[model samples]
Target: MPRVPRPAVVAAAALALGTLAIAPATGDGPAVTDPRVVTHFDLTRGQSPENIALAPDGSADLTLSNARQVVNVTRQGRTRLIATLPEVANPHTPVVGAAVVLGIARAQDGTLFVTYATGTAETGVWRIPARGGKPRQIAQLPPAGFPNGLALDERRGVLYAADSVLGTVWRVPRAGGAPTAWATGAALEPRNPRPAAKVGANGLRFHRGAVWVSNTNAGTLLRIPVREDGSAGAIGTRATGLYAIDDFGFVDRHRDTALAALTGGSEVELVRPDGTHRVVLTPGDGLSNATSVAVRGRTAYVTSAAYFTRRDPNLLLARVHQRDRD
Candidate 1:
């Protein structure tokens, strides 16, 4: 999602990088036990972790949206450079208005796939070798469209990318070729006329037998069933009232519940299938502005871009308690 400037906050997110700290839960929600910042990124260098892809070896690959870089972080909080995208020739572009890397996904072989929403011909999905090298653009999307979220279905060798501005889900082959519009509807269109809040379909994922998408402006989560032929079936709303949700990951293998990042609200919520939800982390828990959530078993990894707070952009780790139920 594009960085939409916001008002400042009072207290900034605390806890030194690589140190452990616990923050009491705000509101009436349950306490998030043992939440700590794994890494404190340099805001001046635009090292904001926008999206996360978990590696098989337990490392997290992140897309530094504004910096146009992909980085890898080990479980011990060690960060390493993966690859950086091309520099933007012009600052002013249509749609999102600026060049930024939004979403990322990793293949089974360690290859990394990312989306670069540049308002130029260079805008598209790029592939980076696992060992690291010059990144290659595999799919080309419309320059006017902001491709914010990406998901790779390895079984089908297809990548699903959500274009926030175009309100379309594009299907691209992993091998590289032309892209096709997989799904499009008003449910994925931006209704908010505000310059900063005009994003739609901000996060995407492939789970079970369907593709799940988050409509940022509409505050809804949609599920599009994948037919036997690998085509999209009728679209359905799985949840609503998820204001400012950017990215999320299923907490359980059944896919009945999820840990969603509420970016503008600066919190992570435990959302259920019936649309009921509860805050699990907040600004008090070292979250400047939660951007994306990646869940691995009982451990949850969350990224805070600090786009609004403009303070400590960091990565947080928390344990997802399974005993609590709605």
Candidate 2:
């Protein structure tokens, strides 16, 4: 079961103070202190959208975890079902509908790569065509591995996936080849002592010659150097104390800053290169269990899965606008 932390009274007061202090600006851009939800889409119950990939045409493709489907949301807010994955038997539990489709990424050529886990020993990555067709298995991960997040290096034709259960990262060629264990260490392991904590390395991204990963259970953001041969070098910590950091997106490429979706914490954290961070949005701002973020220009497309919440079980896809500061 997913853990949800109760909002602290003192912390809530501090957030209100922080938000007020950041208000009122003397700049060229609009005066802004917090992110606001511009619009949202309400999905059916149990869709449980996990990750999203932005298309070149300004559309967004999302992975429906519990529904086991891929959907394309057009720029005009039209949603189209792309594909439905075949059901696989769960090996971890006897639950009837536990299999899930998790991470997704679109290559430069428009081909989509997705990761699916059946709560079983058989988990793998599959490739789908640009216009949506039958999914072809590209590579299968090791037994007992639970792949969660995917990152692609389109220039190098390489794809990386994070194995949450195994606390490892796997790499595979985009042209269909064997998956190799790229990196492994204790830093990727889950730090929470709770037996129900399942995630370790939850999200993976390739940025500026490094592979960045988020550990949901450890509340850490780590950077793994990429060698010339595409192999991983020594791992380094970029930020910590980020609770339930799920999937994040780069906010400022030049500054090496990112916005992370803290699922259990019900907040989106803006993390800097120096480990400094602050909440940019929260449940009070209509971000209940925000799971993933896809940034385009100054707007962030955030998904609220509300996985373990009873308050709002509907899946929401919302936009948060950020103003430029002079």
Candidate 3:
């Protein structure tokens, strides 16, 4: 989450969506649709779904941020506990108040990888076995760095973790090893360093020979080329005006179009290759502070954290339509 207060974000979200209400909705543009709520989580239990990874069996694996738990929500909305990260010796985080789990990614073999920000030596990347047992720390990150998003490059045997507070992306061996700072620059740093909750480089994904990242402070999406030698190349700004984009996923394999979750805007946007975008889903579609989105086949799964609404944190299922131009 950005270093801004939740209440402040709530106000911004409402204002942004209100402005979109008067915009024209063409057939090829943003369309209003009724999305199905798969399940509503208990906010008191800290069951806020932060990042999602879809399984082949139609189940979704998620990290319950404040709860420090990893769970699987099946197609039928049945949720099962996969693993709970061990408690941090110190619960306080640098910018955030408490220790929390953030991003999650699943491997083909059912193994799970996640990030934990504990503001202590324990803060780092963790791995849970496919058979389900204790979670082990694979790499230790900076105690003050808030690692917010994670992505695994299976082909390269590399795992990239984004540090929102540090404005850097760290790479670790998939099997477990020391992490190296893979990418860092001004584009990844928060505009204001003194803000309580300001964040940068909030989400990450390895796509098409580049690492796509979201800058919450700048409201821009960036693409960093992966060089032939597995090093990061120059960074390019792909899109802007994305208010509080938390996480996003590609809509089609052949197209660069993506469905991005706007946390502070309480909306889902369809971002095109040309950097144009339109709001596709909103509060009317059951979105309450959407945090992350995962697209599979013709379906799009969105997770609402409800950090601002303080009400229904839920998982929503919607159908995705492709444009003829793509």
Candidate 4:
């Protein structure tokens, strides 16, 4: 991969995503008494870390949305670059300028899958080796879509990606092949039509026999049943009012509870099966533009991307004791 200039690419992504201003969180909300800072990455490493995948040993594989690199953070807080992606070239409009790397997932055997977009016309999902090796293009998304989040069903050998711009979820083979639309509906699109509002389906996760996804622009959580034939069934709403909900993790599968990172709201919310939620962490607790959450045991790892704002990005950990028993 080529060493793309950071300053220019970061600026171009910020502009394209409409994440130029990240306001400081204010007002009163239920916040974690004291969240622990697990790790911190300055501009030197990358900016706007979007998603995280945990290795078998609990190390974190992070996708830098602005820097176009996959970095590994050890349980002890050490960071190392695993791979750098090529600069995204937009064939559509000059407004997009460049593409940024976003979602990531690790396979059982340690292979990594990543999603990136140069424009809606050119989006890619690539596969990279566990240690560090050449990246191979696994799938190319259809035109007029931006692939953001990725989830893999290792047992079924299926990979799913969420497109933020097209409001669609795609299915592909784990070994790299053509992608097909798995699910599509109005619930995945942004509610507001403002051009600056870059929102849609943001995160993809496979949980409890269903494929779950979060809609950032609509502030809704939805799930699609994975049919026995390996196709998607009807889409159902799991929760709503989760404003700016990005990536999230299940806290208790049996209880159907999850911790969602509300990026636009600048807080981490504990969502219930009934569509109700409560703030678990805020900027007061050091969360700035919280993007993704990964749970290991009882500890939840949240990424504060800060996005295009002045606030720097870092990772935070919080011990989440179930508020109410199932």
Candidate 5:
């Protein structure tokens, strides 16, 4: 059974906070933060919106199923299909892209970079023009070098790929150069850790002088200490209680920390930046199997990945009012 979280003990995720705080709850809506943003991308169950990318221009892009492609979300979350990614598709095998979108980064020049997990014969990394264009494979990951995740240091032009199956993190030069091991299994595990290193690396995010990678097998996230010369090692685990984790995002700038959630949560549980976590929000609070979340500034839009059947659930977006709570 999925664990339930008490309303009083939110820990880090308690407040929607500051100018971005979520509104108080009311009977008119569900019992979550106010004006909650649900999936506006209009995707079917098979589309499997694995990874999403929001550019500085406010245009949003997300990866869909197959050795496939990403499409844009527009019309105020209206579900309309506009374009198909020809470059990322192979009609022979359709399920290739449904695995996981581990890394998402956009360059200063506005070129969007995406990294994939699981596998495919074509390539693991691709770049798309921000002005809207088909993605092209800039680098084809090695045969055995299964890159489960990816992130970039846009200022330095460094690309980091998490090698989940092989237990390593490799860096590839964004300008097109050889790939090198940025971190390995030996450097990722914590001494006398609550759990040992089984799968060394997953999920990559570049923030606060570190490359944060999620450990899927361990339900934890790790931050690797990095040097400008492309040298990196396991700094330490940043968060824990991450279930079947995939990707992570920062709440806002000027903060070294991030906001993350379980890509496949059975119910609500609170996970923290330092890897200490417990149940904070659960079924009783009116959330179910929340797989992904994105913040448009302070308002966070989450997804309920329960679209396995043919029917749409038409779930309502809920909010919490601060005044009502007090």
Candidate 6:
């Protein structure tokens, strides 16, 4: 991963399907059809939406790379302009949420953790109130480091931020103290077979106890254990061999079924920890170009980004549910 001097725009324009994949089936379970879009929101265009979070009870939140406005779409599907331009600071003049919140992650208790930047030459990370209110600075980052993807280790009180350009993962203790780097491919190899030079450290989430992130460039998922000191523990592979994996979400208890947006390869991958994934949605097919993903129980939701950047709108939130599975 070269020094990402600026946020890159590798948006998905279209995705074609070869054919529907073979459905997975099991004893007493209905035949598993490839995942499909449950519902979609096409009104949001050019917002540059990237990361997503679903509350413990299934409420949803959206974040964009460039939008400064933290627009809140409630679980009932009602839209609220929670934080507007001057409100978030409009760090990015083009989009106000520059003071705007991009990633909204929630702990089991509904405490919201937000990742945002001032959109200036320098940026900082913030912890915002999920229900509603002003945001507080969690950590101020060094130059050239824009914290992108975020995941919270609720049980441990740690907030993991993927400093995409730094090609590193950093942590801020919710309890206090300072933020520290967890890992750098410079010392250890990225979990992906791709050389370290190609791995983009982005999109992170907690599954079980591991901190998992999408190595966007190498097309792999990397996991590390939680450390009391915010150090990147022994590195390991969670899923790989898939073309591209953007944002992540899990559904079943066995961790047998999880979801992600495959932007490069163009599709929504219904994946297993083993790395083999069944295509649940495609853009050129019946689906749209999905850039990020989230899942809650019976459904999976995907987001397409900035219309000009993608054939899909900036915000296309679609749901994928288990209609049948054996």
Among all candidates shown, the one with the greatest TM-score? 3
Total backbone clashes of candidate 2, pairs 3 or more residues apart or in separate chains:
0
**lDDT assessment of candidate 3:** 0.82
- Give stretches of model 5 more than 4 Å off: 1-32, 35-45, 57-59, 79-102, 116-121, 186-200, 266-274, 278-296, 301-326
Question: Candidate 6: which stretches are off by over 4 Å?
Answer: 1-46, 84-101, 118-122, 175-177, 186-199, 227-231, 284-288, 307-309, 314-326
Against the true structure, what is each candidate's TM-score?
0.90, 0.83, 0.92, 0.86, 0.68, 0.73
How do these models rank on TM-score, best leading?
A: 3, 1, 4, 2, 6, 5
Model 3 lDDT per residue over 1-326, tens place: 62235654544554344322222323363332558889889888888889998899888998889889999898779998999999877666766767888988888998999999988887999999985679999999999899989999888999999898899999999999899999999999865444454578888877887889998767788999888899999989888878778899888666777888988767998887778788889998899889998888778899999877777888998887655375
Clashing pairs in 3: 2-197, 3-197, 3-198, 4-197
Q: For residue 137, what is the lDDT in candidate 2?
A: 76
lDDT of 2 by residue, 1-326 (tens): 12222333233223223321211212232111445543344445446668889997777898877777888877566778898877676445211126677889898878899987765544688899989998877888865667888989888888999988788999989987898889999988755443345568888888888889998766788999999988899999888777768898886454467778877667887766677677777788777677787777656667777665634522334444444332
Clashes of 4: 0
Highest-lDDT candidate: 3
Backbone clashes counted, model 6: 15
The digit string of per-residue lDDT tens for model 4 on 83-121 reads 988764544411233567889989988999998766654
Q: Please give the range of 10 consecutive residues that has the lowest summed lDDT in model 2.
A: 22-31
Q: Which scores better on lDDT, 4 or 5? A: 4
Where does candidate 2 stray beyond 4 Å? Answer: 1-45, 90-97, 120-122, 193-195, 311-326
Stretches > 4 Å off in candidate 1: 5-32, 91-96, 324-326
Q: Backbone clashes in each candidate structure, one number apiece? A: 0, 0, 4, 0, 16, 15
- What is the C-alpha lDDT profile of model 1 across 1-326, one tens digit per residue? 54554411211111111112222322232234679998989978988889999998888999998889999998789999999998978845444466899899999999999999888888889999986788999989998888888999999999999988788999999998899999999988876655445677879989887889988767778899899998889989877767677898888666557788888678888777676677778999999878898888778899999887688998899887665443
TM-score of predicted model 2?
A: 0.83
lDDT, candidate 4, equals 0.75
Report the error of model 2 at residue 284, Å. Answer: 1.6
In candidate 4, list every pair of residues with a backbone clash: none
> Regarding TM-score, does 1 or 2 come out ahead?
1
